[model samples]
Target: MNRIQRVQKELERANADYLITGTTSNMYYLIGFSEEQMERPLLLFITRDDYFLLVPKLYEEQLKQFPLIVYRDGEDPYSKLNLKENSNVLIDDTTFSLFTIEILNRFKPGRIGRASRILGKLRQVKDDEELEKMEKGVKKAEQLILEFVSNIKENMTECQIERKLKSFLIEEAGNISFDPIVTSGPNSSMPHLRCSDKKVKRGEAIVIDYGIKHDGYSTDTTRVFSLGKPNDPLILEIVEIVKTANEEAEKHVREGMRAKEIDYFAREVITNKGYGDYFIHRTGHGIGIDVHEDPYISPDNDDVIEQNMVFTIEPGIYLPGKFGIRIEDEVVVKKGYGKTLNMLQKELYII
Candidate 1:
C-alpha cells in the first residue's frame, strides 16, 4: 500500500474517523508541501477513503495539483472543513495549541487523539531513498565537523567556533537543523549548553554538538575535543567509557529489540564504569525531517527496533567544575545489526 493507504489502515485500526495535521513535518511527509506555521493554519484532512488539504487562499495558485479547501484572509478556515460530529479525530502532535483548541471547540469530536500514534510508527522505518539521502547528508556533516575541529585554536571563543561551523554548514549542507552547542571547560558539563564567549583553554574539554539539514532530512553528531590533554585524568577515563558505551550499543542493535534495550546497552556501560549519576539524558533520539522524532532511545521507551530505522547512539559523562565527554553517531538498523553512518572516528581529537 502507498503512504496514504497506510495511514488509512492505521486510522481504521485507531477507530478514528479522520486525521488533521497543521503545517508541520507530518504534513510534509503526508504530502510534498512544506510551509512555515502561521496564524493562517494550513491543514491536511485525511479519512479512510480520501484526503485533502486546507490552506489560505494565498496558496491556491501554488498548490494546484491536489484538492484544496482554500479560505480567504480574516475568514474562518475551519468553517469550510466539514467534520463529523461525535467522531474520533486524530491531530498531529506538533500542531500549535491555538489551532488545536480551535479544532476542539469547533469540531466537538467525541474523542481527540495525537496522530503520532499512527504516524510515528510509519515514519520511524525509512525507505531506500531516505537512507541514501541521510547517508550523504551525514557524511558531509562528518567532513564539515572534522574540518571545523581541525581549525579550532586555543583562546578562540565558543561563539567564534560556532560562527565558523555555521558558515561551513551553510556553504556545504544548505541549512542547519538547530543552533550549535559549543562549550568548553566546566560549561561542557551541561549537555545543552549554548554557544558563549568563553575562551577555549588548554587542558579543557570542548564539546561540539551540531546537526545539518539536507533534502529535508537532518544529521545530528557530537564529538568531544581538547586543545591538549585535559587537566583531570578522569576526563580521559570518562571519554573512554563513553566511547565504549557508544560502540557497544551500536554493535548490539538488532531488529525486534526494544528501544529501551539499546538505552540499557549504552547506559549499562557508563554505569558499570562507576559514573551512573554523571550520565544524564537518554542515549539518543530518532533523526529525519525533524532533528528529533520517534523511536526515541530512552530508558522508559519500549518501541520495537525495526529495520531501516535511523537513530543516534550518544553516550556521555559529565563532571561538574571539570569537563564532560560525549561521542555520538547516527546509526541505521539493519537485518542483524546497526550500522553507523558517520565516517569520522569517535576517538577524542587532541589538538
Candidate 2:
C-alpha cells in the first residue's frame, strides 16, 4: 500500500480521530509535500475521511490551487483543525513543542498520542521508488567522496577539505543528510569527533563519515583514508578487524533475523578479536528520510530485520589518545542476505 493508505489503516486501528503533523519528514512521507521548517507552524491534519493541509497565508498563494485549509497571521491554527472534545488525536511529539501542545490543548482532545513510531513502523520497508532514490543518492555520495579523495593532500587541514564538500555535493543534489564528519590523526580516536583545522600528515588515519540527502531519501558512508601507509601497527590491525566485523555482518544479514542478532554478528567478531570493549556504539541505525530512524540495529532491539529495510553496518575500534578505524556500509535486507547500496572499494585507501 502507499503511505497514505498505510496511515489510514493506522488511524483506523487506533480509533484515532485524526493524525495531525508538522511539515518535516513525517509530513512529506505522508503526502509528498515538501516545505521548509519555519517559525510559523505548517500542519497536515489528516483524518480517515478528510485531508486538510493547513499552511500560513504567506504560502497560500503558491499552494492556492490545492484544496487545503489556510490560516493567516493573528489566527489560532487550533480553530482550523476543528478538533472535538475527547477526540483521540495523534501528533508528532518530537517536532511539536510545549507551546504547540498548549495550542493543541485548546481543542481538548481526550487523548493525545505520538505519531513518530506509527509512521516509522509503516516506513521500515522501503518501497521500490524509495530504493531507487536512495540508490541514486548513494552513487552521488560515493562519487563525491572518491573525487574529493583524489585531490586530498598530506598537509591539508581537516576543515580545509571540509569547506569544499558542500559545493561538490550541491552540484548533484539538495541538502546533505548530515554534517560531514572529517577527522584525522589522533582526533580520529573520537568517534563523534567534530571536524577541525588539524592538518593531516603522512601515516595518520583520516576518517570520513558523511552522507547526502537526495530526492527525500538519504545516503551514508564512512571511508578511512591513509595519507600514506599508516605506520601505527595498532591502527592497521584494528582497521582490519573492523573491516572483517563489517563484512561478517553483511554476509549474515537476512529477512526474519532479529535486529539485535545482526549487532551480535559484528560485535562478536570484535569481541573475539579482543577489541570488544573498544567497539563503543550500536552496530548501526535505520536510514531513510531521516539519517537515523526506526529498526535500529543494536543488542537490545528485537525488531526482525525485514525485506527492503535499509540500514548501516558500521563497526569501529577506538583507542583513547591514539587512533580509530571504522568501516560502514548501507545495505538492503534480502531473502537470504543483504545487498550493499555502496559499491566503492572498502579496502584501505593508502593515498
100-198 per-residue lDDT for model 1 (tens digits): 898889879899999999998899999999999999899888878877787899999999999998888888888998888999999999899888899
Best by lDDT: 1
lDDT score, candidate 2, position 296: 93
**Every model: Cα RMSD to truth:** 1.3, 1.8
Q: Candidate 2, 231: how far from true, in Å?
A: 2.5
lDDT of candidate 2 over 1-351, digit per residue (tens)? 766677878898889987877877887787777776776778777777666777888878877755677888999765776667788888875565753566455877888888865788887788888888988889988988888787788778888777677666766567788888888888988989888888889988889998999888878899898887887877778878999999999889988999999999999999999989999999999999989888899999999888899999999998888888899999988666899888987767987
Q: Which parts of model 2 are misplaced by more than 4 Å?
A: 98-100
Error of 2 at 105 (Å): 3.3
Q: What's the C-alpha lDDT at position 169 in model 2?
A: 71
Q: TM-score of model 1 relative to the true fold?
A: 0.96
Question: Candidate 1 has which clashing residue pairs, if any?
Answer: none
Candidate 1 lDDT (Cα, 0 to 1): 0.90
